[model samples]
Target: MPFRSPYPDVEIPDVTLYDLLFTSLTEEDLERPLTIDGSSGAETSYAELRDQVNAIAGALAARGVGQGDVVALHSPNSPAFVATFHGILRAGGTATTVGAMATGKEIATQLEDSGARLLMTVSPLLDAVREAAALVGLADDKIIVLDGADAFESLTDLIAENRPAPEVSVDPSTDLAVLPYSSGTTGRPKGVMLTHRNLVANVAQAAELLGVRRDDNLLAVLPFYHIYGMTVLLNLAILKRASLVTMPRFDLPEFLRIIQDRRCNFVFIAPPIAVALAKHPLVDEFDLSVVSSVFSGGAPLDGEVGGAVARRLGCSVRQGYGMTEMSPVSQLIPAGRDDIPLASVGVTVPNMECMLQDPATREEIPVPESGVSAPGELCCKGPNVMPGYLNNPEATSLTIDDDGWLHTGDIGTVSAEGVVTLIDRLKELIKYKGYQVAPAELESTLLTHELIADAAVIAGYDTEGEEVPKAFVVLQEGAQLTEQEVMDFVAARVAPYKKVRQVVMIEAIPKSASGKILRKELRGA
Candidate 1:
């Protein structure tokens, strides 16, 4: 068990999305010095930030956005994203934040699917939002910009007037707080409906599991559009009262400089960022003495670089696993648990249930009660589980089974100690000569070898007949490893069916903003 609430649960007040705003404003927070928003062109005290949140939340209520209404936000990491997100949730409407770098097609697809009635965006990306609005038959006026003549100027004005946040009774168990989207395993993006209870429970789980504290300066670079960033960095940070260092885009020089300048104590990272930090030579410029730990999530990290970065920084480096469906957190490695970065994504967090089941049958597989399950589809259940999908009942039925379990599409295993190790993606598994092969397993093996900077594994077919595993590799600069040498390196490790029949040396791996390798895009290539 973790540290108990200093105050009784009933007396402490049930945490809601907007409750933070009010508490931050009315309560004394001399402990938190101030916040520097890198994405926004200004500075703010925690007290001032609370007032802005109240203004925006009240402004949203004035516009008649109420319970169950869909409010979308499309912008980079900025103060607007926070205010708009809090405003939408506090007003009782579901908040959906789309990836800032999403293409017109991806944006339109998610927009039409979510049935969002209103959008908040920056001036730079207005056209794309407009295109998405048109796809869903929404009017141009529904597309609200942050700056210029077409800006949605209502909420900012309300903040200036200091209006009370709209009066509304909210239940943690029932009210919708956020509607983050996830692909689950296949098909297009569908909105995962998360209630206020789901979010609060997750906050408690993360705070206890990760040992988040108020003094930790955090680099919150993960996109708010994704659940991992929104929950772990934004909400969890608020609960712990950590100072968030938000950066809109990823430029290595700038990202590194932010750490050095701000003296960030925590970093929420994805696989690509982990790889970059491990391989980049300029990383030595910064003093990371205060960076107590770095948390990697959303995607799996290479054991090689994970170990390298841990040793290089002389700091705690850990990984987490989750999807939007499970209120976004399934497992996380505890800080300073051990020397080896567990190939597993730590263990399932407190209060959440995770298991491995036969992928085809959906029956639970027997394994150690705690650690990682046997290699199979991973499934979870908890209060944090989403109620259902938005405007898509059929899709919801498919993701969450009749038993109320959120079936994660990834193939994984759990050890006796409850450590969850993900070996493959269910959809990405290749059947070579009727034997099953996990692409990620091969990729991890290849990446663990020295001289290989990054690797991607995908299935391809030969002209004669069979599907085969192919590898795309980016070798470290000045390393003289040949294709044959790389293939031989893998040949020593596993079964014949898993061998890389073909190899392609590439300069980079194609990835999404969330840092997941675009296997579909790789197939097209």
Candidate 2:
């Protein structure tokens, strides 16, 4: 039997992403500042954003972009990104958001895979964009720069055309709204086809739990290209009528300064930022008294780190769990709920059904009557789940089952109280002498060490040619510790099999834009 969300289900509107977020705006709502550039302190009012969206859509439509067409948006977080994203959807064109840090080959791969007809990017990234555009045989006319570049039309040029957005009939249930590529940490990047309903349903499902109000100013430090930021920070904030202070990239001093300067009340971050907030000395330099809540996602946040942040900032620190395939959020610690354990991802959002099944036996692991259930692959079924992976039915079939359950490829347990605790990725677990050792469990233990600033754990073969837990550690600034000392620390905290058998001190852990450890890169190295 599957466990349903503890919260009451909310009604999801049958409408396009554009209509769901913009249609109900009143005159007063239009006057509100929706997007603020943290770097330059530039602002975009709801009215200006809407007008820009309309003009961009009209320009794209004039270039033959419409239903069933794909347009790639490759840019960092900016006020212009917000308008261009919605503008692509408004034209009934699926927006395929590419990571800003993606290499030319990676960007080209996404452009070719998504069959993107047009490429939208900024001047700073033109070199990579040009390489990608050329590889995909995209003409110069098909490339639009958000900020002006030589020989390329800018966002202002399109908006200045002053054309009205063409009205297009959209079937919210079936029309693909945005196609964000999966992180591709474990495998090749695949386009996750999300419909308008998928995005709208997730926003509605998460509305109450997130509790982002119109008066709140959300710090958009997380990249908007990632689903975590795209849905949670970008879409949800807009739907709630809150303002977003956009940051192009994460810079600790600047991130703290913006929070203090903008008086941003809500902050959405990844585990890496949480580590900085809890441990970085620069954090003490900023007066972040205005921030009321800090939410973390993209990767699992350690309980001890989360607690440290909550105590230091005097704000609620919570964590959520989701993937790009699920519109990015399915479980989150609801706002104002302190009773839920910091280690847990909290109850599932409304309209979601979750289950745990043994990876080897494929037997259902029922929720324990008393304490936490046995760990298994956490599977979810909900309206927010993607219908399938774009152009990859075999891969989709492998991920989502016949009964609609999306196998998350994550190992976790469900408590009798409905709280979900993630263990680790099923494929990332280390097998030592028939025992499964979760790297996340060991990594979390390593983070508690005072000398360790950040860490990542993976499976490595020992002298005996047996798989063992290996740790890549980043020591705190000016701190030094031997490999033996690191191993001994984790050995005392975790089980013998879960101990760090090997330790390699590195300057920093390679991470994705969303802050997930790039284990594949480490493995390749």
Candidate 3:
């Protein structure tokens, strides 16, 4: 009863992630440009990147980081982040990437749970890294700054001192490569164990699906910490031997300027970026004629907005669907394909099976004979799926069934042609500007405020088509607090992206007999 992929299967390379990237490059390709810094106009060639990865790998092995050891990479997207990430994998260690926006406590939690041996970070984020490292009993010597500084051990110095990269054995299928933390179906963040095979398979699947030519130039505005960027944008670009312009952070003007200056041909963006392109006046200030396509993902893109952008830019606008657990890409609209309908996430990638199922009953739903397919929870099965959640067997079992289908918790329908259309999310996590903002995390933060008696968070959309976290609060008796005060309290503690944007005062949060906050009721109100 499952809908199969429309495209023929692709042969996934049976090699480690490190080998998969390096084995395809010819000697001439090694000298080709790899990563270029958008702000500084600096560039790292493929040859240079490979040398740095080798040196860093040797340095990690010399420092006692070996197979199964987790090295925490806590930095914004930069040339060093690329080197350190690959170096960890090459040295038979797993890299646990932490978002730049993570708070000190959040970083500490991941570090503690991951059991990381080394923390690599830029100098600007060293304060948070130091705080988190202290919480988890990490020694000062173990913290390596990617940017060289007089006070701390530097990643460059370590790599330079170790001339020869140490050799290590890795099992592509069993050895952990990257442990990117994700909030599975529910609860606090947990590490998603992605083996070398998983990463390699996803890269292979996306490569054929996206059809990136070797001469293509990519604009990399998305954060490398996120799975979407880490795989599709960064790793995929490298595998295809495409030139990529890297941004430490996204700035509207800077993003546009790089595309114009670098003559980037393709852009991999989120719905928010696409919205800006359609509506922002500054977009007209730069020449974006070189861009041939704009692919949006991480959150749903309004069909009207996508069509508007396509008309304005005179290029193809498409979307893909996946999550952190599915190596983050199960479906994508292949390039140069105009047959798919607007808002469709295109057909499933090669070697992946997708189907819609009743959310409660778990029965597979058949595609309707006429009109759109029935809406149900989308389930996927593929080799690209993660092994499981780190140390959480219950959540893993609940998310991935015995038959290996990963229940995406997204309510959507699949067309007879295998194209998927997403309608709504069954999960409580709010997708604000493409970032997952968990309601539980916000509710816990809100409870810390003495004035708030009870609180519940739900997602709401603004006029711009971006998700906004709206908090409904029950105040203490005779307590007085303005909406701005409530918003400000959360803003100070959490990252800027996760901060509560709107607040509504309520007498009490509606709850069920089992004491669950009825988020739907609050959302309706």
Candidate 4:
């Protein structure tokens, strides 16, 4: 039998993303700071954000971008990103957010795959954006530089038009809102099709659990392109009417500076940042006493690391578990619950059902009467779950089953009290500093090298105990390549996080009869 969420279900509104977030704002909420740009100390109040969103939506509508259209947002965390993202959704266009660190080729692949009609990016990334836009046949006029650039239209120009936002009808249950790419089970990245209801339901399910107060200053260091940051940091904050202090990127001194200067009370971090907070000497230099809680996600947070940070900062430290296909949050340690184990991802959110099933036998593993249940794939069914992957029904069928349970390729055990603890991953994807690094994507890139005959990649632990992509390469006859050379070659081609960290020269890459790389054999070796 499936284990249901202990909390009572929350009512999810039947409305579009814009209406769900913007419509409920009161006069006091409108006057509050919605987004604060950490770099420039510029703030966008709720009223200003709404106006900017409307202006951008109106301009986008004027350009014929409406229902069923896709616009790719490629930029770091900023006030403009928040407005433009909502603007796209308000205009009934699906927003496909691309990572700021993505290479031109990577961006181009996403642009083409998502069928994005327009590209929005910052001036600093104009070179890569131009390359990607050109590859996808996007004309110069199709690109909207968020920050002003030479020979390009800026967000300021759009707002200057002062056109009224078109009244667009959206079916929340069916209309796509955001298309975030994820490497599900095993493969290169595919866009996860999250509907307006998917996101709205997730926010409603997680709102009480997250405990983000309206007065809380939430730090937004995590990249908003990823679902964890998109839903949790951006959407959830906006819905709750909290003040968001945006960090463009992670810099130790700068991150601490913003928290200290802005007096941010809550922070959402990945495991890597938690590690730094736990042991880094620089952390002691800043006064982080204002932080009431620190929530970690994207990758597993070590119990000791969480404990260390909790002790060091004197704040509540918690973690959660989910994927892009599930609006990125299935289980979270409810706010103010210090009783739950730090290693556990806590109980399932409201309106969700979870089950443990043996991967090999496909037998349901019932919850143990006492202690913890046996490790199995943690499958979940919920309104927050994505309907399917974009344009890939086969992949969708493989992920979400006939009965609606989405097989989250993670091995976890649930306690009798409903506390869930993750053990290991059954998937082939690597979590490097909380970023998904697909092995197949790296292997294909490696095979493209002239001297590389074959390659296989697997999750390997670094000296710091962080998971990284370690590649096993079979060079061509009489060819030689250094580990750094291989790493450098991949570094030049892919994002910095996806670069092959460790390379092992091998005679052959082990494979099964079907020619699939035996990743388990590599992991074992």
Against the true structure, whose lDDT is highest?
2
- Per-residue lDDT over 34-54 for candidate 1, one digit per residue giving the tens place of the 0 to 100 score: 356754425565666666777
> How does candidate 4 score on lDDT?
0.88
| All candidates in order of lDDT, best leading | 2, 4, 3, 1
Question: Candidate 2: misplaced stretches above 4 Å?
Answer: none
Candidate 4 local Cα displacement, residue 402, angstroms: 1.7
Q: Which ten residues in a row have the lowest lDDT in candidate 1?
A: 1-10
lDDT of 3 by residue, 1-525 (tens): 777777888898888898999767799999888998878878899999988998999888989999999999988888888888999998999999998867788899999999998888888887888788878888888889889665788876977786577777888999999999873224688899999999999998889778787888888878778888889988999999998888887778999999899888888887656656876678899998998888887766667667878988888888888888988899888887788876688888988888889886888899866667877899998889998999989989999999888998888888767788876667876888878787756776776676666677899778896889999988867889999999999999999999999899999776421124657677677
Candidate 1, residue 44: the lDDT equals 61
Q: 387-465 in candidate 4: lDDT tens per residue?
A: 9988999989999999888999888899999999986667766888888676756875776676776678899999998
Lowest lDDT sum, 10 consecutive residues, model 3, at 511-520
Positional deviation of 451 in candidate 4, in angstroms? 37
> What C-alpha lDDT, on a 0 to 100 scale, does residue 405 get in candidate 1?
75
Residue ranges of candidate 3 with Cα displaced over 4 Å: 183-186, 428-525
| Candidate 2: residue 355 lDDT (0-100) | 97
**Which one wins by lDDT: 1 or 2?**
2
Instruction: Name the runs in model 1 displaced over 4 angstroms.
Output: 1-15, 20-27, 30-34, 39-42, 147-155, 183-185, 339-341, 369-373, 477-482
In order, candidate lDDTs are 0.75, 0.93, 0.83, 0.88
lDDT of 2 by residue, 1-525 (tens): 899888889999999989999999999999999999898888899999999999999998998998979999999999999999999999999999999998898999999999999999999999999888788788898899999999999999999998889889989999999999998888888999999999999999998898899999999989988999999999999999999999999999999999999989899999999999999999999999998899999999999999999999999999999999999798999998899998889899999999999999999999989899999999999999999999999999999998889999999999998999999999999999999998888888999998999999988998988998899999999998999999999989877778888889999999998889999877744
Clashing pairs in 2: none
RMSD of each: 3.6, 0.9, 9.9, 10.0
